[model samples]
Target: MTIPALEQIHRHASVRHYTPEPVSDDLLERIVRAAQAASTSSNLQSWSVVAVRNEATRQHLAELCGGQRHVAAAPLFLAFCADRARLDRACQLAGLSQDASTLESFLVSALDAVIAAQNAALAAESLGLGICYIGGIRNRPLEVIDLLKLPAKVFPIVGMTIGWPARPLRQRPRLPLHSVLHHETYHPIRDEDLLAYDQTMRATGIYKDPEKGWLARSAQRVQNPERPHLAEAIRQQGFALK
Candidate 1:
């Protein structure tokens, strides 16, 4: 109760279901402005945000995102993109070659887009809104590109669903700081420590089955080498991350 930011930081949860109330244009502007204020590499600011309020577009996006109804149901949806098309065009107009389409450049733009989206999510939470990130956006990236009419050199990094929280919910637990952080030197990972952390996670009751621990679930997810078709999408979108 003492630290004001604690409520904003510690209580962050991904809200899947939402009410029918719509987000206002003024509120959306404030969130976007907050996102724009985030730092960018070399001030390139190679990022763009697409606010999808159209029901038709949202329906298509929902289908593209593995049929997650929230994509269309949320009061507002945002597609954060790593954009180099406009920048490349600008450089060309200035009689300069676009060396900015390199792998490093692409990474920087992607990072900028993620940072901006997170900023916007935090700002929305501060305004008493709830949000959930949609990594499923990348599952059918080419479909997203076609649906949104994104040009070459622009990639949809991620999508976000924003709306009022339906009701109060328990916060999701995170791994302990010691497990993830280090001091002066990196500490060796101990099998016992990892098992203990897994036990703690299982005890948190957030997992559907309390018997299933983090290690088993994570290993299963990684064991399948075949992820969603991203390479083809990326290639079709004109990003040769080769």
Candidate 2:
């Protein structure tokens, strides 16, 4: 027998199409409590979520997120943020300043936000809702920060689109178990693994064929400095990359 949460995780899919129903405040609070339950580093939970329900704001955010229609269409759009503002406040209360300028500080806060978002997503899924993560918010980081009115020590890390699914859920194949799940020692991924997964993806008929497969596409994303302004934007958000 499958555990309830495990079953939910296994059936996870990014939902794009959504019905026109709004998520109730009660449901939102429940999912937020689930997010709070996520473990944080050193008990310093440096993350916050901004829930967007306003129409005009959601429209502007959708544009900022590279015109992802689901962001605008979803009943709720949640922006998960890497936030050290609370820590800064805590330090201020103790008459001390937060030295949260290191790269590690940014990493910890980003990871915390991501983990919390995953918990909230799972909770919403268990409650018969759908979700899609939007990494495109990084495309125009400065604009997003301005529009969201985030404090100096805060930055949007990810956005989640939530609503009831209007269409069938499409579950894409993940990398092979052995390719990702290594043994005691770190193992290098073999070329065959990529090819096999590429072949499996082609069978799905979801993604249009590119000139190259997964590895090539992955490399292209890395090679492209499309979000060149992101690092500077993060620095402007008070994370000193020095």
Candidate 3:
């Protein structure tokens, strides 16, 4: 079974170790062009990206990302941003407000940024480059804002480290499709399915603590509020998040 569309992302894994090879500017420009081709909500295109290559700046960014060494070591780092700055300018030009305070607007911008980032990641992978998406970039959003020197109404949703892999990628198995896909409206996963997945996790050695099941971890995660200050950070970036 050859899936042509998926060949670009086949067995994709986040590569932490990388060689010192530098990603060229021409290659980066081509990747960005592919990213720009991604569709946006109502064509609002409320997204932007900042490519960082300076070692010193990357060191600061790596610290902001909670000491992720890969951020600084990678040949290229990109910050995918939700940018309402352009929308604001458009509003000013039209003498109309886009009501950027709404939660819907915020979600749209964030989704747009994420969608574009995915496109860029795929493009990079197709070119034999490794990429690691750094969610820790949000650990200290305020600092990232200052380090990146982003204008008002612009914030990095995620950071990506891109370079040539130093070693082979470790491919992790994904959950079965039945657990996610539905036949009709909606359906809850059966308990037996979780138990089976737990066994699979243990057999696959994917987790350090294989005794801990995904269902249990998910239950605890939903209750535990991660990144409680994200709303305030988003607000500081000029989004209302209403």
Candidate topping lDDT:
2
Candidate ranking under lDDT, highest first, comes to 2, 3, 1
Q: Which one wins by TM-score: 2 or 3? A: 2
- For candidate 2, give the lDDT of residue 128: 83
Q: What's the lDDT for all of these models?
A: 0.87, 0.91, 0.88
Clashing pairs in 2: none
Model 2, 88-168: lDDT tens digits are: 989999999999889999999999999999999999988889999999989898899899999998999999999999998
Kindly report which residue pairs in candidate 3 clash with one another. none
Across 132-224, the per-residue lDDT of candidate 1 in tens digits comes to 999888988888998898999889999999998887856766777786789999987778878888898888787998767988988887887
Q: Candidate 2 local accuracy as lDDT?
A: 0.91
Q: Which scores higher on lDDT, 1 or 2?
A: 2
- The best candidate by TM-score is 2
In terms of lDDT, the poorest run of 10 residues in model 2 is: 207-216
lDDT score of residue 4 within candidate 2: 80
Error of 2 at 109 (Å): 0.8
